[model samples]
Target: MASQYSDGTLPSGNIGRDFYIPGLTPVGGEDEGTAFDMHARQTRFNFSSNTTLSNGKALKATIELDFMATPNGDERVSNSYSPRMRIATIEYDGWLFGQTWSTFQDVSVLPETLDFIGATDGTIFVRQAMVRYSAGGLSVALENPETTVTPFGGGGRIVADDNGVPDLVLRYTLKQDWGHISAATLIRQLAYDDGNAIDSTETAAALSVSAKVNLGRNDVRMMFNTGAGMGRYLGINAANGAVLNASGELESIDSSGGLIAYRHLWSEQWRSTLSYSWFSADNDTALTGMGVTESTRSVRVNAIYSPSKELSFGVEYAHAQRDVENGLEGDMDRLQFSAKYAF
Candidate 1:
């Protein structure tokens, strides 16, 4: 009756199983027969550069190194460096220091899929360390507030503490010919006394727009975004583990939204993109006690094939659900396949 009845707890004993626990085992021990250890070789190397400074001013950079592969010895380094920087100061109407993307919306309607680090609601924002400006197109940003804190119930249990707030931004963009429109406003600073006197001040506002259309061969991109108490293009709070998003209220989870994507480039080696997103957590006492809930929905589909140009292949599927008024339910579904080569 034990075809594999340990550490693989899934029929509802509550999710577990990624076995292999030596070193005196005791975190839900299993594998009494022993003999299975080999799988932890991760490799990564990346370099990026873009320089054009003869007065047009532009500089971009990315460097990453991660390693771990061993047979008997040698080649065992965890990190040489992981750096990302984008230095910009160009003229034609836009320029100014560090971090990128946040013009508001219309990023080519986004979807190349293969999940190159994104695309499931796809509105991730980063590159902080602020200072930004863009003319004619209208853009403004001043940001700094990357915070973190982690520790979870152990010994005395019932310990849940998390706080996040670091923001100051204002953005505006409008580009026509059928795509691009943006709006953003934010001011955040929260965490007071008990958490160590950080004071308090919060305000959030957001509106994102996107557009692209070409019916002849099928190419369509559409987008919409909204924020109520603000902060949540990519939110985090995993039941209080806090990677970011600390009850500034994420606009009270009144997250409004929209996304529709369609891409077809059938001849350039085939292509496909189908997307969907809808989040309307219309406020429920603002996620009362931080237990979380207002409303949630997510969907994704991606397909890719690029016969040449750095090679490619892909497949993806995702599903999400969140509904709580105290009934409680959080869900996720994923399926993925990928292949790629680039230099």
Candidate 2:
């Protein structure tokens, strides 16, 4: 997607993290001017194959890639593109192993939009190495683990620490003719060893529920998620999962988020979706560093036209608000357009 910003600078870092709005303005003589950008980094390639095992079991594998590298700070000369891996997985019988979407997320209920993630600020979005087993409408997984933490002082930046155990997740789905409902639970072990004889560890957990209802030619989708120390998993890591207190102990933060969306059909070739998302974190000012994000919300509307099953075009408008723990707030507006073709 190509986007133009009117009020504030676009968020930096990982593309997924960029989906969240920033709560603080540019400081230290930094630029806060309007910006325009156009790119086709969303284009991707997919390779898949299926086979039958000697034991009469089915086997499948897939690999996906795209060009969304950071440009290495040289956007003026070479716009050099690089291939990045998005998914690589193998399935045998009812088991899956490798890297793909998190088992805690329900991709089927996500809203459609021009941006990479339509309701990212409130959505459960992540991809990591994992081993999962499925039966009927229930699934379980053990995923890679990492913990993020903030120092006791208010000026230090957040840092990630290695984990001692993997994350565990359980999910179940109920399907009917009119709609479907899904629920998931997650448990994690967070650990930190600063090599300064000040080591700490903590346990975190979260819950998520989602639903989609079909109304003839239209539909409604919704999701709600809440947890303690669910940092990088929800809201694209807008807040640290845990913080170091004055005594150098680990303390988990409280967070909640959700999104609601509706899709309407204008004709056989045209359709539109309207979505709104909200996310909030409760951080202790004395424990967490200052200037941390307190809350974020966004609204987006888009229209898409598909002349053929293989080609489509879309345009979207979005507005977002960010609030900081120190009472500072910022606003952002964006216009995005995209064209996609699949083979």
| C-alpha lDDT of all candidate models, in order | 0.44, 0.81
Compared with the true structure, what per-residue lDDT tens digits does model 1 show for residues 63-91? 54433321222224442323223323323
- lDDT string for model 2 (133-203, tens) is 99999999999998888788656555755688899999999999999999999999877788886589899
List the candidates' TM-scores in order.
Answer: 0.27, 0.93
C-alpha RMSD between model 1 and the true structure: 21.0
User: Which candidate achieves the best TM-score against the true structure?
Assistant: 2
What lDDT, from 0 to 1, does candidate 2 have? 0.81
